[model samples]
Each structure stands twice: as structure tokens, then as C-alpha cells.
Target: MTTDPLSATFAALADPTRRAMLARLAEGEATVNELAEPFSISLQAISRHVKVLEQAGLITRSRDAQRRPCTLRLAPLDDAVDWLEEHRQVLEGRLDRLEVHLRTIQQKNQEHDQ
Candidate 1:
């Protein structure tokens, strides 16, 4: 089954290797061999990770002669960030309300005790 864009972006980012790859790409474009250099995994594995990032719209791979370099595409990351920021604001508002209610209850208890 097909997944939503946000879900796909999250799923691709769930892996540490994929996340690292994205970080590397953030610095600049890198070939599969270049991405695989820091890891002990085979080039094939790195290529697979690249494919997932590409599918998630987090990166784009372009051919430059024999080399296929992967570049970061920030739109998906921006979307994810927007989603997280929206939820954070909602949660923060809930916490603020809860704190107000708790303080009010505490004041009432103090008055009753007095």
C-alpha cells in the first residue's frame, strides 16, 4: 500500500544510517561510494539507503558521467519540521492550561488550610 508523504519521510528518517546519509548530503552531493566510506556496510547497502531517501523526496540523485551523486532536497525536511512545530505548539498550549489549573487548585487548598 502507498503511504502518505509525511509517513514516508518519517519512515526513511527512522534509520540512523539514512539519517547520517542525509546529514552528509547536507554538506554537499556525494556518490554512493563516498557515502559508504565512513560506514562498514557495502556500497550496495548505501545505495539502498540512498534509494529510500530519493523515494521519500528527501534527496535527488543525478548522473554525472559514471557517477551518480545524491543531493539533499529540503522540501520534505521542511514539511516534517512544520508538522513537528505545529504539534509542539499544541502540546505547549495544553501544558500551559494544565499549569494554570494546578496553581489555582494549590491556591484553593492553601486558603482552605488557613
Candidate 2:
């Protein structure tokens, strides 16, 4: 259930469970059983989440005997953050202009009333 890195990232983030898994992984690596312990769901569900994260390149799984430890791979998120930052900057600039415009109108209205 994957298309590309961007699509995979967006798809993985579409589910709350996967996001939580990433949050937990941010602290450190964990096995499937360890990740499953925090949620009320089963380990299978956590496995699915880990798979999605892995596909998104937001996480990785390594074999350690019988345990497959999940680790956060946050490098991919840097691109996402940069994208968001650019959009945010544009919106903030627009808002600043709107504020200035509103202030100009307000000042003119005050002068007219006086």
C-alpha cells in the first residue's frame, strides 16, 4: 500500500496509531512487543504501524535474534518540515500585510470620525 516517499509519508501519517508509533520511536528503538505494550491494541497492529513507518522512511526495523527492533528515521521528516516552513512563511507574510492594511483603515476611520 505504497506509491512514493511523499505519498507513503502522507499515508503513514493519515493513521493516528502510526503517528503514535513514530512518537514512541523518537525516544529510542523498541521491539514489536514493546511498542504494543503501550497501546490497547495487539502487537500485530503495531507491526502494521511499523511497516507503514518503514515504508515512509520514517522508521526502520533491525533484527536482533527473535526481536525486530524499531528505530526512528527522522531524516525524511526534514523535507516535510522544510515544506511546511515555506508555506508558513508565506501565510505569515500575508497575515502581516493584512494587519497593516487593517491598521491603515482603522487610522483613516478614526480621523474621519474626529
On lDDT, the candidate that comes out on top is 1
Off by over 4 Å in 1: none
Per-residue error at 64 for model 2, in Å?
A: 2.1
Give per-model CA RMSD: 1.0, 2.0
TM-score for each predicted model, relative to the true structure: 0.94, 0.84
Q: For candidate 2, write residues 17-107 as lDDT tens digits.
A: 8888888888999888888887898777777788778878988888988888988987788877787799899999999999999999999
Query: TM-score for model 2?
Result: 0.84
Top TM-score prediction, candidate number: 1
Instruction: Note the Cα lDDT for every prediction shown.
Output: 0.94, 0.84
What TM-score number comes out for model 1? Answer: 0.94
Q: What is the alpha-carbon lDDT for the whole of candidate 1?
A: 0.94
